[model samples]
Target: MPSGGESMLESDNGTLGWLNFFHKGIGYFAYTMHRISGIVILLYLYLHFFVLSNLLRGGVAFNDLITSFTYGPYDIFIVMDILLSLVIFYHGANGVRLMLNEAGYGLKHHKLMFFILESGAMILMLLFLYYAWQVLLSGGGV
Candidate 1:
């Protein structure tokens, strides 16, 4: 039978193999981030849809639902809300860029493409930070 140390090493080997697969090249980085952003946006959409569904139940129900989501945990909500927006925007914009490329209209200059992608990501991040700051300053508890 394998020793305890041998089994542990085997498990770790498997884990490292998975990590190595993801670290292969720049393509993996883009694919990983794209997937993560998709998940985040999906979660946000669920939350937003749930909130809007309350509207169908009447104004009072919607108000109560909003209050429950935003009050008491104002700081946490603000942070999540800001992040949700950024995730959605980045995922959407990146998806469009990727689609264009797939359709044979991609950027010929690799450096310029990456630069624009990074710039767009940074702009979105800054916008979220700015909103978070606004909330904090206004005593929204963010």
Candidate 2:
């Protein structure tokens, strides 16, 4: 629409440039996910403090929380744990990819590099999912 051969990322109105950034490449998407997953992991760390603080209240309180987590219908937490594994994997793989890029590697083959890193993350996520499901089915559930 620009008639001068600008990419789709450059909107005719110019105000939507941010919206088009995701289409730039896998690297950008991976970058965004990295930031998001880091935030999520940070938030989870805070939640750990909250949960573990129960120990100070009393051992029984802490034990109850642990019991609730490992028993009953709390399967959702395990599912979340599996999802968190995925986020962790993606965050790590993307971090490595970014490091290699900063070290002057994979600049020319960025897309391929992105695919390889993300594929490895997916595989690792699936492996974790399998192990987590086994735990869930083992009646040790958690």
* The best candidate in terms of TM-score: 2
Q: How many steric clashes does model 1 contain?
A: 0
Off by over 4 Å in 2: 1-20, 57-60, 139-142
State each model's C-alpha RMSD to the native: 10.2, 6.3
Candidate 2 at 77: error in angstroms? 2.0
Tens-digit lDDT string for candidate 2 (1-142): 2111122123443554333435556544555466678899999889889988889989887777776676645646766776778888887887777777767777677678778988998998898788866765795643
State every prediction's TM-score relative to the real structure: 0.61, 0.72
Worst 10 residues of 1 by lDDT: 1-10
Put down candidate 1 lDDT per residue, 1-142, tens digits, no spaces: 1111112123233433423425444443444455678877777789789778888999887766666656644446766777676776666666665665556554454335545776787687887788766765675453
Q: Which stretches of candidate 1 lie over 4 Å from their true place?
A: 1-22, 128-142
Cα RMSD for predicted model 1: 10.2
Clashes of each: 0, 0
